[model samples]
Target: MVTDPRPGQILALVGWSGSGKTTLLERVIPLLTARGLIVSTLKHAHHAVDPDQPGKDSYRHRIAGATETMLATRERFVLFREHRSADEPDLALLLSRMAPADLYLAEGFKSAPVAKLEIHRPSLGKPPLWPDWPGIIAVVTDAALPACPLPTLDLADPGAVAGFIATRLGLR
Candidate 1:
């Protein structure tokens, strides 16, 4: 496969479904962009999803055994593909497709190479995934623990986290 020429940063926002990963990303994007940063996001879907309506041309193409389908407009383009029996596309593939951007934030792929920040709430009663994984760079969580080995920040403070990322990744 051809490689991407973009200089991209990868950070993953991972946590339980309700952990507010998307909400945080929604806020982070604007803050980053305001600072003149170009950002793109990649979300890993765990289920069979169809971005196009059933019986639509794109949908039919997928249902008819096409390995991949592309939908494009003057302003944007979307590629929908069926994995069939293939292994999920790895992080490299996603990164390669990223537009030339300052950063590429990923919402899932917990085991991917990208550095990650896990979202957590004490009431969720689930332990942080960091213990089982080593790629996490920091954590943005509301739950206060005795002491974490990694830096912890407020979940609501996207700017602070964005700054931290900028510093850590030398984006600043």
Candidate 2:
């Protein structure tokens, strides 16, 4: 697989469904922003997604076979690119299309070749992904983890988690 690098480095958050990736991001994003760093996020959804409402013109247009649609407004606009094929764009392609920032936090694309932080919740009865996934830099968990060499951070402490992220990504 070929890899392309973007101006903003990518860090992926990986874990089981209930592992609190979103919760941690909600807390840590603010801390990262307060430190004067621009943060952008990419969410890889497993299911089919449509942001447009059912009765919206944009939705109707796409349903009628428009390959792409743009919803424009005074304050902001969104471009919807309809993919006719089954395969979704890879992480590199998505990142390239995004506006540059100090760092990019990716919530999925678990198998992608990028630095990753595994959010492990022992209570969730899920095995640690760090053992299976390549490029996992550290493990973030609330419970005590045994016999792991990677640095572990407290799940409740967003400050420490954010610090670890900045330090690893060189944004600090």
Candidate 3:
């Protein structure tokens, strides 16, 4: 399926560790938002991560076999749950749970259907992940890749990458 057009756009940033994907994304977010576009980020994690503290009621509920638990305060809230046997939810499910926004910036989930910008570092001893992944719309790399089918942006110029994204999504 294509990215949701309702909320504006969904952009993915994919790369190997230490290839500067996150750093570029971090820089791009503010620049995009400064132009009056709403933005949210989704980061894929391989390890168990709990934004809540241990021994808290919500944490205890999770450890006590509760399938789902929600904690709320005056202005904020969090929902926690554990999956028993089902596969982890995909991009659509995660996006569904988020508040509405003009754009969504996703990091990782390299295999998802979303259009992506891959960060490449030749010194990492790995070939470009682009040629095999046609969904990659662009590349941010220091090394030259002549036969690359995708547009190449300088890794040092975060603005250029952000501009490309804006152009691709037809955003200002």
Candidate 4:
């Protein structure tokens, strides 16, 4: 029962820790890519994280006051930018930096106004977020959900979830 999402749609997978958001993405990304869809992912972290290691050339360049560093190889390239201010960039601004893709799957930013699928596990002892989160279009859960406005999918089935996403993105 997936509806057509807007062009270049960005969907968010949101849930509490241990709810299996990342696990689901690992399953879903291949399904979409195998069908010739270019999928990009944006992950938001609440804590400070550095993808570059210390003592690396790129790390040294950044530490020496370089605003940005690009590490390139024949296979792939990575661009790292440093933000010195307290304010963080919004989702739209960050998205503009990414290369063109058919769909952008966001791993966090629960309140960013994008359509989202919430992962819920009863074992986590947390209430369902879709009850309060207006942007949540569906819920993927292990336990049965009460009567909700959004569609619910079983957490054990990644194929079904991937199909749902493909239909929603109009890739089917």
Q: What CA root-mean-square deviation does each model show from the true structure?
A: 2.6, 1.7, 2.0, 3.4
Tell me the tens digit of each residue's lDDT in model 2 across 1-172. 2265553278889999989999999999999999999998989888988788888998899889998899999998888888899888888888877787888899978988889999999999888988878989999999898877899999999999999998887886
Off by over 4 Å in 1: 1-8
Error of 1 at 31 (Å): 0.3
Residue pairs with backbone atoms closer than 3 Å in model 1 (clashes): none
Worst 10 residues of 1 by lDDT: 1-10
Global lDDT for candidate 3?
A: 0.85
Per-residue lDDT tens digits of candidate 1, residues 70-154? Answer: 9889999888767787588887886766567788888988888667888877778777887887678788888776677889989
What is the Cα-based lDDT of residue 166 in candidate 2?
A: 88
Give the Å error, residue 138, model 4: 0.4
Alpha-carbon local distance difference test for all models: 0.81, 0.88, 0.85, 0.86
Higher-ranked by lDDT: 2 or 3: 2
Q: Estimate each model's TM-score.
A: 0.90, 0.93, 0.90, 0.92
Each candidate's number of clashing pairs is 0, 0, 0, 0
Give per-residue CA lDDT, model 3, range 1-172, as digits (tens): 5455454388889988889888898888998998888898999987777897889888888888998899999998888767876587788888887888878889988888888889998889887888787578899998888888778999888889888888888887
> Stretches of candidate 2 above 4 Å error?
5-8
Q: Given candidate 2, what's the lDDT at residue 170? A: 81
